[model samples]
Target: MRAHGDFSRTADRTPGMTVLTVDLVHHPAHSVLTLHGELDFASSDRVPPLIDAVVKAGRRRLVVDTVGLTFCDSRGLRALIHAERALAALGGGMELVNVHGRLLRLLDITGLTGVLAITTGPGAGQAVRK
Candidate 1:
């Protein structure tokens, strides 16, 4: 796997705030994006452009590893949905991995668990459609 640049963004230097970092790893089968820190409104907007670039580069399947993700707000969820849609538009798909805790609960509460592909480990999860 070849690594791409790290995309880290900070909305502020306020105390108790975590910076969002996105690490991209490219493989023959797919591209893996590992997300760290918060995925709130402050950092959500940074994801789509990267996804678009990946698609433009001819990579279709995407795997988002959320093990390092600490928190995600509604806007963050919207960004993820957008990613799925973006990939789906190209006959590709996005999978969320290492999901647990509040984020997992949020997906369940919002009924997104059924809409988005998710797994606790690599190669897990089914492709469920709306």
Candidate 2:
């Protein structure tokens, strides 16, 4: 179903550019987190709990759609790592889909690309709807 419940701020940080927002889309078997704006220091901290909630609610998979993510830093990486670890411990896991090239490079540099499941199927970002 289509839902617009944001877990973070939606106010524009700049004139026309929003700084960050974390929205949730609940699916039957999974949860889709649509992240917009920068997933840096100010925003990264808000991620892990959401991931935990999905797993806690008995969802086996969580997909982080970063296509709308404009920027991410080490803290963002840490957040993803934390979520991954938590899910693994719970016998569940996460998918980082539609990740951009630059972000992929960051994960590669940090040796996280190997630990996390990344998917880039055709129109993966559009997967949020179905």
Candidate 3:
């Protein structure tokens, strides 16, 4: 199965360019937010609202499926970090799944690997459809 979504820049001013697609999957044990497309400065604006919505929905555990992610920049990483922190503060947790290639390398190089949970394949967390 395949899913698609799009986010664009508004009148708000920002440098750089990015687009984010988020797919929410509901599972028995947890919720999965699958991200696709490029996540950078321009697109980063969408991260905060989405994160807020997830947290407000009272989801205690979340798995972010990054398998479809094509690009991630410092801004994207920062957004992830914010989400991680938010989840922790809410007495929940978040994990990143299916991260590989340059993105994995970037996480390692930036010392973010220690901060976020990275899963390479299935079984990292519960799977659900939404």
Best by lDDT, which number? 1
List candidate 1 stretches off by more than 4 Å.
Answer: 1-13, 121-130
Q: For candidate 1, give the lDDT of residue 50.
A: 76
How much does candidate 3 score in TM-score?
0.80
lDDT for model 2, please: 0.77
Tell me the tens digit of each residue's lDDT in model 1 across 1-130: 4445434444454777887888776666678888889898778888988797778667899888888899999999999999999999999999998898999999999999999988975454232110
| Alpha-carbon lDDT, every model | 0.81, 0.77, 0.75
Q: Candidate 2's residue-wise lDDT over 5-108, tens digit each? A: 44445453555544767777778888888887878776777887787668666787788898888788888888888888887887878889998778878888
User: Which is better, 1 or 2, measured by TM-score?
Assistant: 1
Candidate 1 vs 2: which has more lDDT: 1
* RMSD (Å) per prediction: 4.5, 3.0, 4.1
TM-score of 1: 0.85
Better of 1 and 3 by TM-score: 1
**Could you tell me which 10 consecutive residues in candidate 1 have the lowest summed lDDT?**
121-130
Give the per-residue Cα lDDT of candidate 2 at 66: 86
